[model samples]
Target chain A: MESNRTESRENRYLNPYLGGVLLGLVVIAAFYTSGRGPGATGALKGLIVTGVEAVVPEAAASSGFVAEYREPLPGHPLRSWLVFQMMGLITGGFLSGAFAGRLKFRIEHNYRITSERRLLMALGGGILFGFGSQLGRGCTSGAALSGMSVLSLGGFITMVSIFGTAFALAWFFRKNWI
Target chain B: MGPLVIYEVISENINLLTAFIIGTAFGWVLESSGFSSSRKLAGVFYGYDMVVLKVFFTAAVTGMLGLLFMSLFGWIDLSLVYVNPTFLTSAIAGGVVMGAGFIMGGFCPGTSFSAAAIGKIDAMVFIVGLFIGIGLFGAGYSIWQELYLAADMGHLKISDSLGMSDGLFALLLILAASAIFYFAEMVERKFASHRL
Candidate 1:
């Protein structure tokens, strides 16, 4: 009975169009002030570079790959603007969940799949996404969405490719999601 | 008179703070839109729900229009806004891999963070995997350097490349988006019974 009530509350999310409007406004504000789009993967990348530097200073410094991240101009790599923004994302997400009574600790998977399978797939997916974001110079939010907003041709291409590839492979991963 | 940061109206410190504020709104909107739910996100593929399409295109078009009006009014310098460079090869290749990941993981980096915020264990695992993958990429950067840098066309805009006015492109985009929204609604209604 208690679970059902929580589920009901979870269903009370904002209308998709309204949510999109709010999100777009945020992007606009970001462009107007920061002169850049909001980013997620960049923060994660910074953290990874910082972690490597902390554990093996020589390895991090020796690599021409991590050279830019070795010392982010203004301050510590971990203290980059994206890092703080990500922190705020966590905070805001939690607040929204809490307010909407949607905060639940559970694994979400289709009934056809086991929790274990779901987790493994998630891990594999994350790795692919991480690697791909680095290659593409951004992920969905950063490169594609933000890029498209500014009429960037690359952004449109990335957006189409991402969705096109997903659609092509959706059937194969049907069990995992649906 | 706009893009306040570019005009030096706000200090860098304050700009960073504003980033946090903007991110808060971004996260809040995403979560409230049900993006934190993997099933919902993946629903776009199966046609059970097209929330992702609806929200994404709506948001993109809205932002695009906002920038257009802002620039027309001379409130913001559109050129000053950063554009992701056109790296043709890597863009397509990376998008392909990310698409596969999207299907398997059911959450993109941003959405996963939101899911993790709500104590989703799968999202947490995905986050850990992201760190590891990035670490590996850093280690193997030499192998990827060439492919990553292939076909760099610099900051090219779609409107410019297609030889159409920006205003015309935006109008076409709005029409396309509206059509997608209409189709999405119809698909959802038809497939509402299908489980995802």
Candidate 2:
């Protein structure tokens, strides 16, 4: 009974449309002030570049992919706009979780799957997403959301492709999710 | 006049500060909307929950309309905003991979960060994989360079490609979104019993 109450409480969330409007306003705010949309993969890429540069400066300097981020900028890669935004994202997420009493160290997965299997799947998925984000030049947020806001054809294409592929493959992965 | 940073109305430091503030808002909204839960996120693919569809489409339409109105009011110059460039082969290929990732992982990059912040161990592991994946890409740049840079169609706009005014496209999009929302609601009700 105690667990049931907590489960119900945790399930409570903002209305979908309201959440979307707030998210939209935030997107508009990002563009209005910075002339760029919010991004997650870009920030992660910065972190990756920073890590690579710190461990092997020469490798970073020599590699074409890594070198692009090493522009003769005065500040560290972590000090860039996206990185700062990402930090705030963590902070904000934490705050929201705390307020909702949902902050807990746990592995979320379906009852049908073991925690170990879920974690493995998560890691594999992350690798694919990370690699794909680079190839596509952006992730869902940067390429799709931001792109669609500007009516960019690339954004629409990416959006359609991502959703289409996911839908088509959903049946195969039903065990993992359903 | 807007996009204050682009017009030099705001300094660089201020812009970074703005990014943090905007990100905070984004995170808050996402978490409050239940995006921090992998199970909830995955439900969209299974027709169990339509929150993702509703939230995503609404947000896109809202942002599109906001930009159009802002431009109409002369509050901002739309041209100054960054439009994602099209690399046909890479975009399609990358998206397909990401789609598979979404099915397996149940969270996108942004959503994963929020989930991790909320103390989801799976999310943390996923992030580690992301770093490794990105590292692999950087290390093998030569192998993927050809495909990544291929078929570059510079900053094309959907409206221009369709030969319609931005306003007209926006209107059609709004209509399409409404229809989708209605369908989503029906599906959600049908699958209510399957919800986790």
Candidate 2, residues B81-187: lDDT per residue as tens digits? Answer: 99988899999998998888888888888889989999999999888878877777888999999999999999999999999999999999999999999999999
lDDT tens per residue, model 1, B72-152 = 999999988898899999999989988988988998999999999988899998888788777777889999989988999
Q: A11-108 in candidate 2: lDDT tens per residue?
A: 88999999999989988999999898888888888888888888998888888887666663447887787887888888888889888889999999
Please tell me how candidate 1 rates in CAPRI terms: high
Question: For every candidate, what share of the true interface contacts is present?
Answer: 0.76, 0.80
- Candidate 2's TM-score: 0.97
Supply the global lDDT for candidate 1: 0.88
Candidate 2 stretches greater than 4 Å from native: A1-3, A70-74
For candidate 1, lDDT tens digit of each residue in A124-161?
99998888888888899998889998998888998888
Relative to the unseen true structure, what is the C-alpha lDDT of residue B44 in candidate 1, on a scale of 0 to 100?
Answer: 97
Candidate 1 deviant stretches above 4 angstroms: A1-3, A70-74
